[model samples]
Target: MIHEIAPHVLDNQFKIQDPKPNDYCLVYNGSKSLLKKEGNGYALPTVAEIQKLGFEDFEGHYLLNIDERAFFLLAVAEDYAAPEGYEFTGNRAFRPMAPVERLGGATAAHIAHWEALNKFCGKCGNVTIRGEKERSIICPKCGNVVYPRISPVVIIAVRNGDKLLMAHNIDNPNPMLFLISGFVEVGESLEQAAHREVMEEAGVKIKNLKYFGSQPWPFSDSLIAGWTAELDGDDTIHMQAEELSEALWVKREDIPPYATDVSISCCLIENFRTGFTLPET
Candidate 1:
């Protein structure tokens, strides 16, 4: 039995609230933190600096890390009360911030997506304005509506009894292997995406697709829909050079040293091999 990656854990806590004023928080671009405006220059504030500034009148959701040392704050566009040049730094830096960083990476990516895609109306090529009480942009001239876009992707752990299939991607920064995954293509269902990805990446067909769970991969604004599948039959393991660096089946007991908290690939294999899922609460 496969298991979830321990949602709602202390580190993955989703404490939803409204944005308030004076509440400084950390906003990350990949691994970098958004900086605070000091005089004409901007700088990363220490935790002590954030505590002194104060947070009030802000309302938003927040995701806190396990150690409680960091929190990811969220907010609407209207709640930002800063003067000019007080926006976030687009470059990568994860410096500390006041506990009020309202723009988590996922939320910031959504904001960027809205701004990038809503420049012109789809129907009339007119300008679009942000909607009230909702996270949408509307065009008054054409009445065309645009909402935040979420890319749904399938991530599957392909299994053949005690041995599971894992592959190394060419583009990943780390040299570790990853579970089979691909973005959901238009006109196809989630299962189709899983099948296509497995066959394309590992040259194996999978069946008995089972839905496991989901995670918000904010790094690229993707909603990862996870699943586990069984290989259709013994087949050749051919790697797609463009996508994967190597393709092979590894025993479940051999994966622990390579596991990371960032992905569900190892967790699924562990659950299947151990007969009990890891606890999260």
Candidate 2:
């Protein structure tokens, strides 16, 4: 199972006190900037300078919240370039690097996001400074607190033997099929959330519910809780047009090549496709 690197971890306790001057700080204009190693101190490139550089060679590293526990890593494209330059490649070469390298980008991105969002103190309407022992900013005036946010979501793959249930998103760009998935409601447990999503998205009840692993889905800061469920009644799928363009059963061999290959959804589906199962949850 995957859990996001909580932002609170980056609070003062986890920060590198003697960080190298050339350490990288992930910057964002529209996309993200190249991993710029820190110099003398943490220097955020000016917007003008970022504009001058255009968009290139950059990737999203991660997200940071004011609290130490609200952090997540992501890979974003730095598609900018400076004028008259040799067309910087940003960090495309490293965009799909190993998870370990990507981890650094995530940390930098999270911290940068936290710092940028905390420029002013909401409580005192005064200036805020980054706390040395935590990831939050301290207001010199009145004391109020802020933190990063995380949205929990469920992604499940419904299986009945060698066949799998899949759906095409009602609002997708391509006609790729996807598993039933959705966000958890305010007052729902993870299991309840999964069942609710399956029912709402596919109009089918599930049984033999088993908790699968998890993945840090940073596209919109989602923690994907993966699961496998047994289809109820007939294999016939009743599509929810508001939520899906189409829904159907597909044989494992007929599964289309994934559009976004790096997702827990794919992982869960593939596991079932290959007859792999974890210790029954």
Candidate 3:
């Protein structure tokens, strides 16, 4: 749901160019991003504000083109502090910002994290330089190129008649209920990953797998693929103690309250709760 920035287009074509006065500057320190507090929300800094910071010789990457304007990502030192009226916020806490601002900030954070992690070439332990033509860091000695890593994840809603499966992750600090989700392992297709996750976490077989949608979840650089499936055999849920603390099926009419505008998982759950059918693939 974070990618659904309607009215404002997002173009990620790699371009080597300098920042314009109207362009946005996404400054980041490790996983946190610098955002200036507007009246009630936060916003990215303009090129003028960045220029006032006096950061010279910093790494910059063309992240995306939003509404035909460029947005560049700049990774700053961890000790970098925000000027007056500005504050640093982690990428995960971007819900308070506008939809377009949140999307841009997430993308910038992803690139910044990648840049910080790959400052030195993993292959030869030599300092790497930014690639001039693409979004990558190239090692001058070993010629090893590193790009942003995106892990594939699957979020599925298991259906059985008018009921849907829900679970609470053992590691999640929030008590909000969520659908079964897991990362795709090596040598597994998206559908395979979906079924594997449901079975492993909920101890139930799922079939009739239908692709729902996808979202770029930059919390940890994940591309979430959403799906809907039907419970195959038994509905008895033997929750995986390590991954889930609770796993159960709930009737559609009895579905609990959840946020639908934030993530794809919430969207999937909301669709089922409201009886919104997906178009055939």
Q: List TM-scores for all candidates, in order.
A: 0.65, 0.66, 0.90
Question: What is the per-residue lDDT of model 1 for residues 20-131, given as tens digits with 9 covering 90 to 100?
Answer: 3333354333333346666654554433444344433332234344334344343334334443434555422211222222223334444544455676888899987766
Candidate 2 lDDT tens digits, 1-281: 22233432333234423212233334443344343333322223322343345423333222332332222322233454423422222333223543433444444444444455676887667887555555556886776666554578888889877789888887666567878888999989999998888888777888878888777654445667888889877666677889898888889888855423356777777787667778742
TM-score of 3: 0.90
Q: Considering summed lDDT, which 10 consecutive residues are worst modelled in model 1?
A: 93-102
Candidate whose lDDT is highest? 3
Tell me how far the alpha carbon of residue 36 in candidate 1 is from the true structure, in angstroms, after superposition. Answer: 7.5
Q: Against the true structure, candidate 3 has what lDDT?
A: 0.86
lDDT of 2 at 118: 70
Global Cα RMSD, each model: 7.8, 8.3, 2.3
RMSD of 2: 8.3
- Number of the top TM-score candidate: 3
